[model samples]
Target: MKVYDDKHIKNVVFVGAHNSGKTTLAETMLFEAGLINRRGTVENKNTVSDHHEIEHERGTSVFATPLHTEWRNYKINIIDTPGLDDYVGEIISSIRVADTIAVVVNAQNGVEVGTEIIWNYIDTYHKPTLFVVNQIDHMNASWEDSIKSIKSLVGNNMVLVQYPLKIDGAQCIIDVLKMKCYKFGKDGGKPEKLEIPEDQKELADHLHNELVEKAAENDEELMELYFDKGTLNENEMRQGIRAGMLNHDLFPVFCVSALMDMGSGRLMGFIDNVAPAAADLRPEQTVEGDILVRESNAPTALFVFKTLYQPSLGQITFFKVKSGEVNLNDKLVNSRNGETEVLNQLFIMDGKKREPVSKLEVGDIGATLKLKHTETNDTLHEEGKKITIKPIKYPQSRTRKAVNAVNQKDEEKLNDALRKIHSQDPTVEMEFSNELKQLIIGCQGELHLATIDWTLKNIYGVEAEFKEPKIAYRETIQRSSTANYRHKKQSGGAGQFGEVHMKIEPWYEGIPEPEGFNIRGKEEVDLPWGGKLVFYNCIVGGVIDARYLPSIKKGILEVMEEGPLTGSYIRDVRVMVYDGKMHSVDSNDISFKIAGAHAFKEAFLNAKPKLLEPIEELTVKVPEEMVGNVMTDLQSRRSVIQGIDSEDHFQILRCSVPQAELAGYSTNLRSLTQGKGTFVSAFSSFQAVPRNVQETLVSSN
Candidate 1:
């Protein structure tokens, strides 16, 4: 291994839908570079990228694996990411360091829903992107249809650099930009370059002219040269394509059969020749909005993008040098917490293999051993520098469940494991809900939850169960009511007596105060749950001692904590202690508190109490034909259609549904659309539950 400068280092990320041959393409790329003796297949579960045991069992990638290949004099750092949306956190973290995005498309499936989902992120980042159509050797592969699909998704700027054709029962790719034909042997390696055949000359010329025009469009000089000579050479085309890619104005398409190793060598050659290297990318911004200098002369800084825990190794932290260089024993301070961390050892990682290196320059990805305080998304920089690299922002969780240990003794151990897991993958989060009295775990979907479950049992040896999460429903009054309570306690020494009269009303912002009562003192409080409480005192004559006023308010709040209707948190209520009586010696704070609580409870019950449940605003994207099916499913969950909009060939449905009905919506939607539907949801305002639903919930409670 050699330390390549930022100019020769290209950071590429592979993303696509499952079965799109992303892992296979990565394996082929490594083998083609002569970095690996033999290529591994996903079916055999021996691939370098999907090395995890869980991935082997599932036959899919579970983590983003970083590997390197040297083509010519360039070192390509490849991050092979998971195609399943469940592991999208892995994809996003990998993309943060990506200089170029290579979106692999399966020829059979074309543009899938998952591809569209991943495209949104790439588009948002405006990363230089290229498309690779894989599985060209398959029996049912259709290159033309795949091109159409690619054009539809990426628009007209997608130019075909190569197209596959069967030459006498063998696969031969016609390179339009180079104006040549590549014919491969039966073993599918090192294609023989030859002139275009006579029969295909006209078609190749037409496509070649198209590529020339596309390349010239980005540069005036090239455009002039194209008009004068009616063509541009391969080097000129490469230069124009590189410019277009850096600007994200053009996306070139290539075809490959990764399993058969037909076009991977050509793909790597193009990457080395045209893809933007780390130094060619725009300087990344820091958290403070200052651009970072991606050079060895700048302050040394490393962005910790991922943290993984292995039973054999305690923890492995993956990072990319954002600036300057790092040596084996360099001490860098974490910009997040100002804690100095020692880089004990550095290794260039290839799957589970570690290639020990003495130094890593800027833009090179590598791993290090445990740092007590360093976690994912943290920035470690020179001691005096305040540079913090901008971190990767992950999507919000789509599923939540109450997780509890089956064996009570493992409860603490379960929490420890979960916390460690959260440090490894930030998308797996845990929170304790005081209102529901449950420890809830949130993740992308059901598959993510299953992985958590498996890790608990397999890695931590802690058996756990995931149950339906309890909704944090709220209680409020619908109408005004009045009630009075008297507390009298008899004892041998003395007797306690207190009486209170209160008027309870539904509270709203900008509502007028009570019209009839002469208000003396007022106290308004913002409830921690969600609403406000307006407390007024009309005791002009001091019927009860002023000191007891605080006690009365406290009592009312106590009842509000556990509402009379369903014991949920009560919010948005107005309480007025208009009248009260007390005995100077017997009516202490305790007596007043009891009377106040009783009065508030009685009035709450009579004031037309209502139960409110959380509402989530969901935006679901599905194909046109599946809209009806999605609509039907939403109707069954009592979802209200807010609006619908169309984009491309899909329908975007904006819906409002109760969170209680959306326990396993992700899995259900995937099944309904055959993995062609995706959605995102956020918490909206709460609304009152239906009468029958409220009755059932109350009775169950």
Candidate 2:
């Protein structure tokens, strides 16, 4: 393999909805580029991408696969990403490093929910994108409807560069820019270029004018030239299109039947000639807000965008060269942890296969065998250089489940396996909640959790069960009350005796001193988990020794840690140790601690304790027709509607609902909206539960 400079490299990512033929298009591109002798189909499960066992079993892509091919003196690195919303992490990571994104659209279905979801990410990164209206060979495929849908759903910036030409019941692509028709053979390889037919020439001419105008709009000079000459030369048009694409002012749409390999060769040629190169992309901002540009002669730096744990290869780290070139045996420091690792071997990936490469130049994507401390989002640079790339921001886990190993003794094994999986894919969050006392696994959706389960059972030989996780409810007081308790044990020798008198009240930002109480000392402490605990030492004239005050506060904290109401943690409470009695011989730290605990428990019960449930702010986007149904469903879940916003034909509903009601909401929402709805939620605050619900929870606890 030959090392290519930055100008010769093209990083393109294929992203779209599930079953949109991204993998198929990628396979066709590889075959047409002569990288492979025969194109692999998704049904056979032999495509270059989607090689994982889970992907094969599910017949969908689960991980982003990197493959490369050479076309017309350009080395095109094609990143095939998963289309399901569950694996959006892959799409996001790939988009971060891609100079251009080819958003594949299903010609039959048009713009779908998944497409809209992924489009938001592309817009977030502000990447130059093109639409590939794929699967045009289907009998029901309507390019006109798909284009109309794209224009309505995405924006009006879409301009057609190619249109489908039906020849003897077979689909051919007529390129507007080249003014030629590419007709494929029975095997769909090496298309024959012919002049546009008379009937299609009129439509092609109109599309060509539109394309030229869209491209010229990006440059003042190009616009002037178009006005003067009423047209642009082939070279000038290509340059103008590249500028428009890089500026995101124009998104060209092309038609292709990836399954039949019709028009894919022309698409590859367009990508190679017109797509933006790495050098054309905007410089990446560093963690410290400094810009770093890709330069072949600059200091060597690579950003790890994805990590994989291959069964044979322990940890395979995929990275893009951000600055300079890197050769084998070069030692690089992990900017994240300052750990040094030698690049023992560098390899280019084709699906699951690895081909050795001596060096990788700037803007090129490659993988290295093992790094001690390097993982996803870590920046690897030359030793002594402190450079860190901006990390990829992954979406929060929308669903979670409490996982338990079938065999209790295998709990450790299951945890170890989960940790490995997390290291490979950080999108899955594994946490042990002390309050809930459950080992929870949080992921994008149910399919993501299911994939983890399959991996545990088949890959690691561990069987686990997933169940609804317990809600982390809290206990607090609504009113102030006073209670006293004396702990005395005079069995034999020195007796254990202590008495505590304390007043408990709800704490707020401007809480006033309790009536008939003097503030001796006040300390505000934030809890490790959340909320705050304000301790007021209102003891007068050493009624309770200052030394014993610490013991009393400690005891109060123990009760707060495990509330007396339902064993949940208590928060935002002020405790005043107004008065107490102590025996010199028996009233040690232990004695005061026990007395304080008893007194606090008694006062908490008498002060009108209330149960608080965690509430999450949810933002749901559904079609306008389904808003009523979704709102009704949310009302049943005890939701408080905040406000609504409209986006085109979609309605965005904002509400606050209890976390308990969110269980299985993802699946239910999908079913209710026929897979056209999407939502995101975040913890808002803890609110008092309804009286009936509180009673049920307390009784169950």
lDDT by residue (tens digit), candidate 1, 1-701: 68899999999999999899999999999999998998898889898888988899889888999999999999999999999888889988988889999999999989887888898889888899999999998998988899999998999899988999889988899988777899988789889999988998999988888888888998889989999998888999998888888888889999999988999999999999899998888878898888998899899999999999989988899999999999999999999999999989899989998899999999889999888899999999998888999878888888899999999999999999999899889999899998888999999988889989888998899999899998889999999999999999998777888899999999989998888888888889999989988999887688888888888899999998988777899999998888878997788988999999999999999999999999999999999999999999998999999999999889999999999999899899999998778888998988999999999999988
Give the lowest summed-lDDT range of ten residues in model 2: 164-173
Give stretches of model 2 more than 4 Å off: 490-492, 518-523, 529-532, 536-544
Model 1 lowest lDDT segment of ten: 537-546
| Model 2 accuracy (lDDT, Cα) | 0.90
Give a tens-digit lDDT track for model 2, residues 115-177. 988888898888999999998878888888999988976677899999887788656789999
Q: Write down the lDDT of every candidate, Cα atoms only.
A: 0.91, 0.90
How many residue pairs clash in all the candidates, one count each? 0, 0
TM-score of 1: 0.95
